[model samples]
Target: MKIVITGGAGFIGSNLARALTEQPRVTQIRVLDNLSTGHKPNIAGLDVDFFEGDIQNAVLLDQVLRDADAVVHLAALPSVPRSLRDPLASHHANTTGTLQVLDAARRAGDLYVIAASSSSVYGANPNLPKHEDLTPAPMSPYAATKLATEAYLSAYHHSFGLPVLSFRLFNVYGPGQRADHAYAAVIPKWVSATLAGQPVTVHGDGTQTRDFTYVGTVCRVFTNALLRRIIEPRPVNLAFGTRKSLLDLIPEIEVATGRPAHREHRVPRVGDVSHSQADSTRLLALFPEVTPVPINEGIAATVDWFRASAVIAASS
Candidate 1:
C-alpha cells in the first residue's frame, strides 16, 4: 500500500512517515511538503519519496495524492499568535488547503484521509478534560481554521463518501521540533532556554495546564487512525488524557537538563486558554490497547535529543 503524508518532514509528519516506512503492509511512503517550516534534515536517511510543494497547489497536491491508498494531512500554519498576525494566511492554509487535499484524495478514489487537528478548538470554555462532544469555541484564527477544516472533513465524508478521520492533537512535543519561530510550541522553546541557562517565559503565571502529549505517542495515534477502516465522520481526541501545568513541569525540565529555569511571567497571549485536558475515553474505547507513553519519559528523551543536537551543548 502507498501512503501520502503532508507536512511529512515536520516533527509529527516525520514521525508518522518513519512509522509507515516500517509497516509490513505499507510498501511506499510519499512525503508531500513545502519545507517552509519543515527542515530537509528531518527526513534525511529515511527511505521514502519526498515531494517539495505547497498543499494549496491543486495540481501538485493532486499528483501527490494519486495512487496513494491513504492521505494524512498535517500541513498548516500552527500558532495562536501567528494566526492572529496573519488570519487570512492561516485560514487559507488550514481551511482552503484542507479542502484541496481532500478533493485531490477523493478524485484519486482514496477512502482514508486522517487529518491532523488541534485542541485549540476547545478555546477558553473553562471545560476540564475536553471531549469530542464539547461545542467548539475557537478563539483565534488558527483554531477557527482547524474547526473549519474539521467541518469540511465531515462534510466530505457524508456528501462524497470520503472516509476522513480528524485526530485532535493536544500539546504535541518532542525531538526534531522547531524552536526558532516566534510562536513555536512551549516544549522546544523551554528546552532551549533551560539548556542555555536562560529564563523560561511562562505566560500567565504558569498555572495554565495542558495535555502535553508526546509526539511519538501522537505519531502512533496517527498510524492507528490511518490503518483503521473508518466508515464515517468521526473526530477523535488524540491525547495523553493526563494533565500537566507549566509550573509543575518546570522541575522536570530542570532535572532533565540539570539547569534550573529562571522563569519570566508574561501577560497571557490573546486566544490562549487557561487550562485544558482531553477526555480520551472515546479514543481509548476505539483503540483499547494503545496506551500513551508517560510524559516524563517523553521529556527525558526530548531533552537528550536536544543535548545531542544543539551545537552549543559542548560549550555549555
Candidate 2:
C-alpha cells in the first residue's frame, strides 16, 4: 500500500510512520510536516519520503496525495491551552488544514483519508464514557475546530462519496512525546519533572480524569482504520475505554520512575475538562480484536524512554 501521513514528523505521526515501515504490505510511506511543533529528529532514520511543508499548501497537498492509496491525516495544532491563547492559528491549522486534506483527497480520487479528531470535542459534558452520538459541546477553540473538521469529513463523505474516517482520539501518550515544550501532555510533562526532581504541577487538586490512551494503541487503531472500510464518516472514539484520574496516574508514574514527585496543586486552567472517558463500542464493533496496553505498562515504557533520553543528553 502507498500511504502518506500528514504531520508525520510529530509524536503520533512519527510512531505511525515507523509502524507502517515494519509492515510488509505497506510499500511506500510519504510524510508531510511543517515542523511547527514537530521535531526533525522524530522522523530521523525512518524509511520514508519526507516533505517539509504545510498541509494548507494546495500544491503540496496535491503532490503528496497523488497515487497514494490512503492518507492518514494527523496534522493539527493540538492543545487546549495553546488554542485558548490563539484560536485563529489553531483554526487555520486544525480546521482549514483538514478541509484542504479532504478536498485534496476528493480531487485525488480512490484515496482514503483518515483524520485525527480529539475527544475534546465532547468538551466538559458531565456525561461519563462519551459516545459518538453525543452532541458535541466544545468548550475550547481547539475542540471547536476539531468538531468542525469532523463535520467537514462527514459532509465530504455524503456529498462527494469521499472515503473518510475520523478518530476522536483521547489523551494519547508514550515514547517520542515531546517534553521540552510548554504544551506537552501531562504524562510526558509529569514524567520529565519527576525525573528531574522538579515539582510536578497538579491542576485542580489532580482529580480530573482522562482516558489516557497510549500512542502504540493509537497507531495500531489508525493502521486498522486504514485497511478497514466504514462507509460513514462518523467520528469513532479511539481509546483504551478506561479512565484514570490525574491523582491515580501519579502513583503509577512514581512507581515507573522509582521516585516521588514534588507535586504543586493549583486551580484548573480555563478550557480544562473535569472528566473524560471513551465509549469504544463503535470502535469495538469494527475492530473487535483490539486490546489496549495497560496504563501501568505504558507508564513504565514511557518513563524508561525519558530516563534513557536524559542519560543520552547527559552523556552528550
Candidate 3:
C-alpha cells in the first residue's frame, strides 16, 4: 500500500511516517510538508519520498495524492495562542487547506483519507469526558478550524462518496515534539526548560487539565486505521479517558528528570480551555487493541528524548 502523509515532517507526522515504514504492507510512504512548523530533519533517515510544499496548492496536492492508497492529513497551523493572534491564517491553513486536500483526494480514485481534528473543538461546552455527540462550541479560531476540518471530511464522505475518517486528537506529546518554538506544547516546553535549569511557565495557576495521549499510541491507531481501512463519518475522540492537571504533571517531570521544577505561575491565556477529557467509547469500540501508555512512563520517555536532543545539539 502506498500512503501519503500531509505535514508528514512535523511532530506527529514524522512519528507516523516512522511507524508506517516498519509495516510490511506499506510499500511506499510519501510526505508533503512546507516546513513552516515542521522540520525536514524530523523525517531524516526514513524511507520516504519527501515533497516540500504547502497543502493549499491544488497542483501540489494533486501531484502528491496521485496513485496513493491512503492519505493521512496532519497539516495545520496549530496552537490556540497563535490562532487567537491571527484567525485568518489559521482558517486558511486548517480549514481551506483541508478542503483542498479533500478535493484532491476525490480526484484520486478510491483513496482513503484520514485527517486529524483537535479536542479543542469542544471548547466552552463545559462537559467532562467530551463525546462525539456533544455540540462543538469552539472558543478560539483554532478550535473553529478543527471543527470545520471534521465537518468537511463528513461532507466529503456523504456527498462525494469519499472514504474518510476524522480523529479528534487531544494533547498528543512524546519524542520528536519540539520545544524551541514559542507555541510549543506544554510537555516539550516544560521538559526542555526544567532540564535547562530554568523555571517552567505555568499558565492559569496550573489547575487546568488535559487528556494527554502519547504520540506512539496515536501513530499505532493511525497505522491500524489505515491497514484496516476504517471509515467513520462522525469524528471519533482519539484520546483515552485520562485527565492530568498541570500540577499533577509537574511532579512527574521532576521525578523523570531528577530535578525540581521552578514554576512561574502567570495569568491564563485567552481562549484556553480550563479542562479537557475524552470519552473514548467510540474509539475503543473501533480499536480495542490500543493500550494507553501511562502518563509517568510517557513523561520519562519524553525527558530521555529531550536529554538526548540536548546532547546532540551540544555535540554538533
Candidate 4:
C-alpha cells in the first residue's frame, strides 16, 4: 500500500509516518508538508519520502495522490487561538487545503481519504457526550472550517463515490506538540511551563474539560479505517470516551513531574469551549482493540519524553 500524509512532519503525522513504516503491506509512505508549522526533525532518519510543498498546490497534490492507495490529510493551521489571529490563513489551510486534497484524490482514482477533523466542530453545544447526529454549531472560524470540511466530505462521497471518512479527534496529546506558539494546545503549554519550573497559565479558571486521547491510539484508528472496506452511517469520534477537566489534569501533571502546578488564572480566550466529551461507540465498531491509555498514563509518558530529551523540549 502506498500512503501519502499531509503535514507529515507535525506531531500526529510524524508519528503516523514512523508507525506505518513497520506495516508489512506498506510499499511506500510519502509526506507532503510545507513546513510552515511542522518540524523537519519529526521525520528525520525515517524511511519515508518527504515532499515539502503546500497542499494547495494542485500539481503536487495531484502527483502525490495519483499512486496513493489512501491519504491521511493531517495538514492544517489547527488552533482556535491561532485561527482567531488570522481567520484567512486558517481558512486557506483548513478548508481550501482540504478541498484541494479531496479533489486530487478524485482525479487520481478512487482512493480512501481519511480526513483529520477536530472536536471543536461540536462548538459550544452544552450537551455532554457529543454524538454525530447533533447539529454542528461552530463558534469560531477554525471550528467553522472543520465543520465545513465534514459537510464537504459527504458531498464527495455521494456524488463522486469517493470513500471518505472523517475522524473528529478530541484533544490529541503525546510528544512533538509545539509549545510557546501563539496557539498552543493546553496540554503541551502546561507541560512545557511546569517542566520549566514556571507557573502554568490557566485560562478561564481551569474548568474546561476535554477527552484527551493519546496520539498512538488515534494512529491505530486511521490504520483500522483503511483496512475496513465499509464504514458506517455516521462520522466517528476518536477519543477516550471520557472527560477530564483542566482542574483534574493539573494534579496528574504534578504527579508526573513531582512538582505542584503553580497556576495563574485569567479570562478565557474567545472561541474556547467550556467542555468536550466524545462518544466513541462508532470508533469501536471499526476497531474494537483500540483501547485508550489512561489520561494520567498518557500524561506521564509525555512528560518523560519531554524530560528525557532536552533538545525536543527546548526546541518547542
Candidate 5:
C-alpha cells in the first residue's frame, strides 16, 4: 500500500511513520512536511520519501497525493495558546491546509484520508467522558479551526463520497517531542523540567485534566483508520480512556525521574479548558486490539527518551 503522512516529521507523525514502516503490506511511505514545526531529525534514518514543503501548497499536495492509497493528515499549527496568540496562522494551516488536502484526495480517486483532529474541540462543555454526540463549543481558535475542518471532511464525505476519518486525539505524548517550544505540551515540559531539577510551571492550579493518549496507541489507530474503508467521514475519539490532572501527573514524573517537581503556579492562560476526558467507545469498537499504555508507563518511557536525548546533547 502506498501511504502519505502529512507533517511526517512532527512528534505524532514521526511516530506514526516509524510504526507504518513495520507493516509488511505498506510498500511505500511518503512524508510531506514543511519543517515549520516539524524536525528533520525525527524522520532521520527512516526508509520513506520525504518532501519538505507547505501543506497549503497546491502543487505540493497534488504531487504527494498522486498515486497514494491513503493520506494520514497530521499537519497543523497545534497549540491552543499559539492559536489564541495568532488565529490567522492557525486558520490558514488547520482549516485552509485541510481543505487543500481534502481537495487533493478528492481528485486522487478513492484516496483514503485519516486526518488528525483534537479534543480541544470539546472546549469547556462541563461534560464528562466527551462523546461524539455532544455539541462542540470550541473556546480557542485552534479548536474552532479543527471543528470547522471536521465539518469540511463530513461534507466531502457526503457530497463527494470521499473515504475520510478524523480522529480527535487527546494529549498525545512520546519520544522525539521537546519541551523547549513556547507552545510545548505539558508532559514533555514537566518531564524535562523535573529531570533538570527546575520548577515545572502549572497553569491554573494544576487541576486541568487531560486524556493523555500514548503516541504509539494513536499510531495504531491511524493504521486501522487508513486500512479500513469508511462510507463517510466521522469523528472518533482516540484516547487511552483514562484521564489525569496536571497535579496527578507531578508525582508520576517525580517517581520516574527520582526528583521532586518544583511546581510554580500561575494564572491559567485564556482559551484553556479546566478539564477534558474522552469516551473512546467508538474507537475501541473499531479496533479492539488497541491497548493503550498506562499513563505511568508512558511517562516513564517519555522520560527515558528525554534523558537520553539530553545526555546526547550534553556529550556533543
Candidate 6:
C-alpha cells in the first residue's frame, strides 16, 4: 500500500510516518508538509517520499496524492491561543486546506482518506466523557475549524462516496513533539522545563484536565484504520476515557525525571477548555485491539526522549 500523509513532518504525523514504515504491507510513504510548524528533521532517516509544500496549493496536493492508496490528513494550524490571535489563518489552513485535500482525493480515485480532528470541538458543551453525538459548541476558532474539518470529511463521504474517517484526537504527546514553540502542548513544555530545571508554567492553578493519548497509540489506530479500510462518517473520539488534571500530571513528571517541578501559575488563556474527556465506546468498538499506554509509562518514555535529545544537542 502506498500512503500519503499531509503535515507528515509534524509531531503526530512524523510518528505516524515512522509507524507506517514498519508495516510489511505498506510499500511507499509520502509526506507533504509546509514546515510552518513541522520540522523537516522530524522525518529524517525515515523512508518516505518527501514533498515540502502547503496543502492549500491544489496543484501541489494533486501531485503528492496521486496513485496513493490512502491519504492521512494531519496538517493544521494547531493551538487555541494561536487561533484566538488570528482566526482567518486557522480557517484557511484547517478548513480550506481540508476542502482542498478532499477535492484532491476525489480526483485521485478510490482513495481512503483519514483526517485528524480535535477534542477541542466539544468546547463550551460542559460534559464529562464527551461522546460523538453531542452537539459541538466550539468556543475557539481552532475548535470551529476542527469541527469543520471533520464535517467536510463527512460531507465528502456522503456526497461523493469517498471512504473517510475523522478521528477526534485528544491531547496527543510523545517523542518528536517539540517544546521549543510558544504554543507547545502541556506535556512537552512541562517535560522540557522540568528537565532543564526551570519552572513549569501552569495556567489556571493547574486544575484543568485532559484525556491525554500517547502518540504511539494514536499512530497504531490510524495505521489500523488505513489498512482495514474503516469508513465512519461520524467523528470518532480517539482517546480512551482517562482524565488527568494538570496537578495530577506534575507528580508523574517528577517521578519520570527525578526532579520536582517548580510551577509558575498564571491566568488561564482564552478559548482554553476547562476539562475534556472522551467516551471511547465507538473507538473501542472500531479498534478493540488498541491498548492505551499508561500515563506514567508514556511520561517515562517522553523523559527518555528528552534526555536523548538534550545529549544530542550538547554533542552537536
lDDT of 5 by residue, 81-167 (tens): 899889999999999999999999987885888888999999978898899889899999999999988998899989888888888
- List candidate 3 stretches off by more than 4 Å: none
Candidate 6, lDDT over the whole model: 0.95
TM-score of 4: 0.96
- Candidate 3 TM-score versus the reference: 0.99
Over 4 Å off, model 4: 229-233, 311-316
lDDT of 1 at 88: 99
Best by lDDT: 3
RMSD of each: 1.8, 1.0, 0.6, 1.7, 1.1, 0.6
Lowest lDDT 10-residue stretch of candidate 3: 102-111
Better of 4 and 6 by lDDT: 6
Q: Write the residue-wise lDDT of candidate 1 on 83-154 in tens digits.
A: 999999999888999999988988888548889888999996777779998988989999999999889999
TM-score of each: 0.96, 0.98, 0.99, 0.96, 0.98, 0.99
How would you encode candidate 3's per-residue C-alpha lDDT over 1-316 as one tens digit per residue? 9999999999999999999999999999999999999999999899999999999999999999899999999999999999999999999999999999999998989589999999999999998989999999999999999999999999999998999999999999999999998899999999999999999999878999999999999999999999999999999999998999999999999999999999999999999999999999999999999999998999999999999988998999
Model 2 off-target regions past 4 Å? none
Q: Please give, for residues 126-150, the per-residue lDDT of candidate 6 as tens digits.
A: 9888999998999999999999999
How does residue 112 of candidate 3 score in lDDT?
A: 95
- Off-target runs (Cα >4 Å) in candidate 6 are none
Candidate lDDT scores, in order, read 0.86, 0.91, 0.96, 0.86, 0.89, 0.95
Model 1 vs. true fold: TM? 0.96
